[model samples]
Target: MSGAEVAGLIAAIAFLIIACAIALIAIRIGGVTREIKDTVAEVNKSLDAINAEVGPLTHEVEALLTKSNTLLNDVNGKVAAIDPVFTAIGELGESVSDLNTSTRNLASKVTNGAKESGKVAVAAKVSKKALSLLKKKPADQEAVTNGK
Candidate 1:
């Protein structure tokens, strides 16, 4: 074989090898892309499932919040309704306190009156003793003059 023909054959074989390598790389890239696409599809399915489960829960939470607000408003209204009763009770307590003070004053007056009554009793006894002494003094003076 001629040297020029042999060189041409070598070049053709080297080109075939390069082409095979490029084909293998392309195949590998295609396989990686397919795997990425499958993973993305699975992630989308999981997101759809999560959304399905959470949708009802979100609605339930909103309903519970609405009920709670209603209950709070009802409690506030009830508290407001009883405000007058509370005021009346406070007035009653004040009345009781006033009554207690009046009772204490009455007791003190009675105690003072009792002390004064005791003094009056002692004064009456002294007055009676003085009268008896005055009557005897006149009689004794008459007897003394008669004897002279």
Candidate 2:
């Protein structure tokens, strides 16, 4: 064969090898794209499932919050209603303390008055005895002797 024809044949074989390498790279890239597409579809499906399940859970949470608020309000209202009773009890305690003080004062005055009255009674009796000793009569003695 001629040298020029041999050289042409070698060049054609090298071009074919380079084209096959490019084709192999394109095939690998296509395969990787398909895997990525599949993964994205699976993620979308999982997100849809989660969204479907979350709807009822959201409503239940809202309802629970509403009930909790109502219960809290009721407890607060009851506490407010009973507050006056505690205030009245405090006032009653103060009144009892005042009554005890007044009672103590009255008892002290009565004891002092009783002691003074006892002293007055003793002085009056002693004065009556002295007056009778000063008023004795001799005429009563003579009358009694004549009558006997």
Candidate 3:
């Protein structure tokens, strides 16, 4: 072939090789961009799921706070309600103590009266025995005097 024609054929082959290399680089870049997009989509999906779960958790925390307040109120109300009962119990205790003291005094008085009655009965029995012995002796003396 002619020198000019041979040079033109070589140049065309070099240009085709460079075009193929550039096309391969563009394909690789497109694949990388697609992977990055997929990764971003997955992250967004995970974030959405976490947000959905947090909704219920937030409500539960609020409910717990409400229940705690209600329990505190109930405790306060019950304490207020029992105040009068406690006062009444104190009064009842005082009355019972007074009753016990009165009972103790009455028992002591009864015991003393019983002891006095016993002493009187013993004294009367002794007098009766002495009188009987004196009467028997007198009868015996008269009998002896008449015989002599």
Candidate 4:
């Protein structure tokens, strides 16, 4: 072949190889795109199934939360209602303590009074004995004088 024709032929073959490489790249890209589309579809299906299951669970959870709140409120109300009873009990305990203190004070006073009374009784007995002895001495003196 002539030089120019051979060079042209070589150029055409090079262009053809470049075109085939581009085609192969396009085919791989197409395959990747198809896999991506399939994955997206599966994800959408799973999302739909999750939504179907979670919708009722959401309502049930809300109901349970409301019920728990009501129960807590009832318990709080009962605690508030009995608060006065507890206060009264505390007051009663304080009153009983005061009564015990008063009783102790009274007992101490009574014990002191009894001790003073015992002292007075001893003093009276001593005075009575002294007076009786003086009366007997005067009678003895009078009898001796009569005998003389």
Give per-residue CA lDDT, model 1, range 1-148, as digits (tens): 8999999999999999999999999999999999999999999999999999999999999999999999999999999999999999999999999999999999899778868788657767999977765677666757754873
State which candidate, 1 or 3, has the greater TM-score.
1
Looking at candidate 4, the ten consecutive residues that score lowest on lDDT are 139-148
Taking the tens digit of each residue's C-alpha lDDT, what string does model 3 give over 1-148?
A: 9999999999999999999999999999999999999999999999999999999999999999999999999999999999999999999999999999999999889778868788657767899976765676777767755873
After superposition, candidate 4 runs with Cα above 4 Å error: 1-14, 112-148
Report the candidate with higher TM-score, 1 versus 4.
Answer: 4
Number of the predicted model whose TM-score against the real structure is largest: 4
Task: Spell out the clash pairs found in candidate 2.
Answer: none
Clashes per candidate, residues 3 or more apart or on different chains = 0, 0, 0, 0
Writing each residue's lDDT as its tens digit, candidate 2 over 61-106 gives 9999999999999999999999999999999999999999999999
Q: For model 1, how big is the CA root-mean-square deviation?
A: 15.5
Ranking by TM-score: 4, 1, 2, 3
Query: By the TM-score metric, which is better: model 1 or model 2?
Result: 1
Model 2 lDDT, full chain set: 0.91
Better of 1 and 2 by lDDT: 1
Deviation (Å) of 89 in candidate 3? 1.2
